[model samples]
Target chain A: MNLFLDALAWIVAPERFEGSSSLFVRLGEHLYFTAFSVLIATVIAVPIGYLIGHTGRGRELAVGLSGAARALPSFGLILLLVLVMGVTNKPAAAFTAFVVLAIPSILAGAYAGFEAIERRTINAARAVGMTEWQILWRVEVPLGLPLLIGGIRSAALQVVATATLAAYIGLGGLGYYIFRGLPLGRYDEMLGASILVAVLAIVIDAALALCQRLFVPRGVAAGRTPSLRTAPARRRAMVETSTAP
Target chain B: MNWVLDNLDLIGRLSLEHLRLSITPILAGLLIAIPLGWLAHRYRLARGALLTSAGLLYTIPSLALFVIIPPILGISYLSELNVTIALTLFVIAIMARSVADALDSVDGNVRQSAVAVGYGALRRFFTVDLPLAGPVILSGLRVAAASTVSLVTVGILIGVESLGYLFTNGYQRRIVEEIFSGVVMVMLVALLIDLALVALGRLAMPWARRPGRAAR
Candidate 1:
């Protein structure tokens, strides 16, 4: 406890506090890396996932690959990149995170969204002479938008949190504070870093949740709300009906 | 092949250490979280708050959580305790959500019938809800356990001795074989845990025998 207090005091001391400006700079760098990676991943993943999910060929392979990507340990992957890329932020942090973070949500979203669309609607669009791209843009993407957004939300949160581990490769971020503080027995610095990371995750997740609500079409939202609200009651009714006879 | 031959003993020791560090804490976390989740389900208003809190904990970066603990609790290799805490925080949220969802998925008639038959709330829960909900809860545990295997490796970055220690060491020292050994060990541990959990799920909840019948 004394060590913790002392660490806190050290962090607050004006002289020590002066060095803290770097913490903010590091945070900005971290966010920049994460944001770019997520953006790139979204662009690649969404389109690829849509194509596969719509085409219905090699979909199992695509989805399985994405799941595999997600399952691979970030620490191990990051370390592997360090070996190949030699510790620069661009390849080590930004590029790797893009590949690791983007695949699962994008694929799942596209697959779920495309699969959810009614077959007759697609047939009508095609029957009316819509091009394949037209059917995709006019029919699939719009309808799938809600689920796609859900995927992006998850991908964004994951990328932001995992990006902190970039500190291991000497790219500065809030993780730098945590990693540097740990070896030196600086508890307050670690606490501050942890709190900041946690808060950032919550803020990002909440913001994404709001975005999902905003971007999801009103019709879909309306459709889902009634079902969600009545699910329990429906189950209860089913129970009663089943037992009655 | 040459690399494996040279470091077989070291790899074996590291693998054993990683398994030791990961297994117990996750089991403990699952044990605690499932009951809390059940409680949350019983009380309607508490469910959202409980899940949200757990979700919040889930977001904290594993490395950041590790660094934060030593300062507060004081650091040691026994930092196993801290890793356990951090792992627990994540597992609780996951397990709780899964448990609540599973309970909700149970045939409502089962519960209503049990109630009508004069089975008390506790008895109904034990005999009906728990059995029906078991598969979903186990699925959650499987996910938590698999992830915990990976997360426990983060403990190494903070100075705990495990397979992750080998990975980090290999990176720092530029020993490719050691890195391979560490990576392979962690993956094997994760796979084994997943298989074990699946087997347990099958044995404990016969309903899980049919895939997709339980909550995916």
Candidate 2:
């Protein structure tokens, strides 16, 4: 422990931590890489996932594809990209992170959203002169909004964490601070990075929880609230029914 | 074909190392997480803290965690113990969540009935709750095990030689065969571990063998 503390002290002592500008720039770049990848992935995944879920035409294929996408290790995929893209962060880190992080949430969200809708509800929409597209836009999508948002929230957090790998390929994120701290025996800098990552994750999670509350059906949120003693019973019923044949 | 024939021994060694590295941490993680999760299930406050902590841990990048740990612990990459700690952190968080969720999913009436009976808290938990929660916990373990196997590959970046070392080595030398071999080997190992977990789940939780009956 003493050695670790000594290492941390050594890393931060030179500057007396006066250089906030460089730290901010590095932080910005890291956030940029993470946010951009997640944004791009969300754009591509949500619509396609929604389409598959609503149509039920290619749901199996979409689910299988997403599973396969997830099974591929992120590091292995990044290395594969680095081989072809030459590792300059543009096509390498961003695209790889997008693929790894996007598919699962998108598919899970879409499936949950679609599944959450009562079959009778869809039939009701269709019987009332609603076009298939209109039903999707007006009925199914809104109902699934909570699950969809939850998926995106999970994916976004995951991407931010994984994006730190970009430092290895010379893309320069907060991971650079971490790796630099490691070799230089700088425990403080390393701790700083870890703390920053943890804070970012918690903040993002809290924000998403707020978003989920805002968008989820009122009944669902009410069922989850502490004041509702019957919430657990309802939650159990929901889980059982969803898993039931 | 020549490359395969020449490097068979090295490949075998790497495969063994891969299993050793992956399985040790997962088993250790399950051991710690299941108990911790059970504790959380017994206590409401513990449940909230454990779940939130698990979520936070899940969101931290595995690579960054690995890098950050060595400095804090004053450890070297060469130490197997250090790598185990890194991998265990990832596994514990996921497994804890799974265990807690599984226990929570058990029928409330069953728990109340157990309490009404002569069975003590520990006995009730062991005989009734754990048995009922087995499938959900195992499923979570399966996910954790699979993810751990893949993440173990990242340990190579910090100088620990698992299958990931093969890809890094191959990339440096521009040897496509080595990279391909690494990727294939890791995938195969991952699949095998996943299958083993599924089989174990079936044996441990007979309820899971019957569709539509097991708790999610």
Candidate 3:
């Protein structure tokens, strides 16, 4: 309880909030790493997800790749990458590691979002004189947005959490406090920083969950959209397996 | 390769520690999650609350949880117990939802028939509901297993010993082969656990291989 109290005080200490290595600066660096990695992952993954979903090809490759990635220890991956790539350009190696961490969930989210759409609806869209491009945009993308966001939701959460670990490689983030504090027995700084990271994760997750709910097509009223909140147990469970990283 | 060969005994010992650390929480979490999942499923009033709390738990990173546990539990921050407790929480978060969902997936009529045959709630749960829920639970188990094994490696940062020691030790020494070997060994352990779970599922649920009872 005393340690917890000290941690809470540490969070409120004005001295801790400013300066080059202040709480706010580390927080900023943390979110910056998270957003940067997720952005790159999104660009690379969403298109591949689209190709897999739209054409129903190479899905085994996607699934197999993602599964393999999930089993990898992120800590090991970072250290290995840093050593292999030469630590001189640490950001490239670290962010590449972060991108790898983000890709599987986003890719699964993108493709699974498309797969969640009703087959009959797609047939109807085609019958109404929609071309391939038109059907994909008009029917698939809007409906699949919810799961895509869910994927991004989990991916962003993963990156946010791992960005803390990225600090292990000497990048600046909130993790700097915890990693730096531990060796020196600075419990307040370590505990205080972890609480901040947890809060950041929860707030981002709630925001994304809201985004998922809001962007669920208004037409999906009677039947639930395929996002975890409203999707049936089975579908959400499938999403859970992919999103765990 | 030379470092790895020289450290064979160290690797074997850490691998055992890694497996022990990983498996404890998975087994313990399953035991806790089933009851929690049952509570969520059995009581409509609590379903939303139970599941939402479980969802919230996952958002807290394992590393954060690792640090937070010692303070709360009065254990040393570096103790193996803290790792198990924190990991068990995560597995519960992942599995409880899946367990509730797994129970929900059990056909309503099938459960009704079990009740009709005069089986008590406990009896039916064991013979019918649980068995029926087994495959889904096993899948959730597999996911939890793989991730748990991987997550256990993070404890090295806090000075808890496991295969994760290789990561820190290798990085400090700049031993590329050593780091590579650590990564491979963790994945290998996870893969072996996954296969074992699959085999156990097959042995326990023969009907699962047939039509209408397919494996996931």
Best by DockQ: 3
Ranking by lDDT: 3, 1, 2
Model 3 lDDT per residue over B47-165, tens place: 88989998988899878888888988889988889888999999999999999989878876677777778989899988998998999899899888988999999999888898899
Q: Which stretches of candidate 1 lie over 4 Å from their true place?
A: A1-21, A87-94, A116-135, A224-245, B69-78, B211-216
Candidate number with greatest lDDT = 3
Q: What does the TM-score come to for chain B in model 2?
A: 0.91
Candidate 1 per-residue C-alpha lDDT over A1-245 given as tens digits, one digit per residue, 9 for 90 to 100? 76556555654566533464565576787778777888878777877788777898777787556545544567766776677566554455446755566668777888788988989989999999999999998888888887888888778767776678767777676677777776786666766677677777778878877877787767767889975775453233224443221
Clashing pairs in 1: none
Which of the two candidates, 2 or 3, achieves a greater TM-score against the reference? 3
What clash pairs does model 2 have? A8-A187, A8-A188
Alpha-carbon local distance difference test for all models: 0.73, 0.73, 0.88
Q: Write the per-residue lDDT of candidate 2 for residues A146-239, one digit (tens) a residue.
A: 8888888877776766666656555666777766765676656666676666666678778887898798767656756764664343333223
lDDT string, candidate 2, B1-216, tens digits: 555567878877987898899999899999899888987776778888988887777777776677557656777745677778988988999999888878878887677677677679789889998998888888788778777887888788667888888777777775656766777788788878878887877787776687655332
DockQ of each: 0.38, 0.34, 0.47
Model number 1 iRMSD: 4.8
* Count of steric clashes across candidates, in order: 0, 2, 0
Model 2 has a DockQ score of 0.34
Rank order (by TM-score, best first): 3, 1, 2
Off by over 4 Å in 2: A1-21, A87-94, A120-130, A182-188, A217-245, B1-6, B70-78, B112-118, B211-216
Off by over 4 Å in 3: A222-245, B211-214
